[model samples]
Target: MALALLHTSPVHVPVFDALRDAHHPGFPLRHVVREELLAGAAARGPEAVAGEVTALVAELAAGGAAAVLCTCSTIGAVAEAAGSALAVPVLRVDRPMAAAAVRLGRVTVLATLASTLAPTRALLAEEARAAGLPGGDVRTVLVEGAWERFAAGDHDGCLDLVAAAADAVTGADVIVLAQGSMAAATARTTTALPVLSSPRPGLAAAVAAATRAAR
Candidate 1:
């Protein structure tokens, strides 16, 4: 079965490709990237943002995708809500990460974009509540000045800033990299705490869901 990934940026292409090769070898993939989707969502209101995500999900469904993974945390809720109306599973790429974080108790969500922190925290809270996990403190730490470097294509520098922030985090049961783009930074980080990134867990969840649905 084929799979489609809706991304807000091309930065995640390589990461997803590697992940697909490793986890779901030979699965045909289709990627639809709207580099400005997140930036545009800011100027647009909630309805517009939801509409954009819904439309993307529909397109993926129409393209024969057995499942769709929305790889943007900021618009994750919209994608998930849209999933309810579709036959195929449409999952937020961070859904698994959020679920994992909830089980870990004290969680620190690390992000480069301030916009993602709120939604990610909300997702973690929602996941925890659903699982009957006790309400735990979920804090957010934004890497100062990191987004600008990423916007400018200095990915190495951006990862450096994120790694520094991850290294400094203490006392959290788990550290979550808020964006799929930030997943690469996990390799650079050195910490005793479990550090979670979205791509692997999220894609694995999507594959499992899609496979079950197909059967």
Candidate 2:
């Protein structure tokens, strides 16, 4: 059985591919990238793309994908709701990371996109509830100008800003980098607080779910 991944940015293709190769070698992966999906979500909100997201997920599941992973945080809730309706395993990449964060007490979330903050916070709250914890104490920080730098192809500049934002955070038990692309910023942060990013844990969960479905 193969795992399917839905990504908004082409940058994530190689990142997840490499992760799968190293940790789950020989696993089959099908990647679908549609930049416009994220653009639409950012412009009009995730609900605006609910129909399309569900349709694409249904198509992938029907095509023999054991599990589908939505790597875009902006549209994650919609994708997950679609999965529930269709009886397919549709996992959001930020979930496992959010689960980890909720367990750590106060969480400070850092994001480059304005659209990512709400979804990430909501995911953390959901995870907290699922874990039988009180709704989490979550704070969101937007790294100003970082998204523009990323869009302009200045990846280093974007990450630099993200790292700076992470370093400035305080009174938090952990810091969560909201986007998979922001994972690189973790290395650049000097904060003593644990920093969490979705890609590694998320992909691992996807692999496990696909394996279970294949059985």
Candidate 3:
């Protein structure tokens, strides 16, 4: 059985592919990139494209994916909802990061896009509640102009902005990069506070889920 990944940006293809190669070599992966999905979510709202997102996820599951992972935070909740009715596992990439953040206490979330902020915040709250922790101390920061750079294919510019934003953050036990695309920024950040990104831990979780589903 293969693990299917639903991504909004094509950049994530290489990122996750490299991750799988390094960590879970020989694991089967199926990637589907729908830039329009995130485009619609950003232009309108995530709810506007909920049906399309859900349909795509159902299609992936039906196509023999042992597990489906939504790598976009904007439509993660909707994808997860669609997965609920399926036999296969459907996961949002940010969930593992959120679970980790809630345990750390006082999380500061950094995002390049305004659309990702609310959903990520909600995910953190849900994770906190599930873990019986208070969700009051989480903070969100939008790195101005970073999304524009990312959209223009300037990944380095985006990472620089994210790293700078992370360095500027204060009074937080840990910092969470709201988007998986921003995961590389963790290495560039100068702050001593722990920086959490979804890709590594999230992919690990997906691999484990796929392994179990295959059994």
TM-score of each: 0.95, 0.98, 0.99
Worst 10 residues of 2 by lDDT: 80-89
lDDT of 2 by residue, 89-121 (tens): 999999999998999999999999999999998
Model 3 ranges with Cα > 4 A deviation: none
Evaluate all candidate structures by whole-model CA lDDT and list the values in order. Answer: 0.86, 0.93, 0.95
Model 2 scores a TM of 0.98
lDDT of the structure predicted as candidate 3: 0.95
* Model 3 root mean square deviation, Cα atoms: 0.7
Candidate 3 C-alpha lDDT tens digits along 82-102: 899999999999999999999
Q: Which residue pairs does candidate 2 place in steric collision? A: none
- Between candidates 1 and 3, which one is better according to lDDT? 3
Candidate 3 residue-pair clash tally: 0
Error of 2 at 174 (Å): 0.2
Poorly placed runs, candidate 1 (over 4 Å)? 43-47
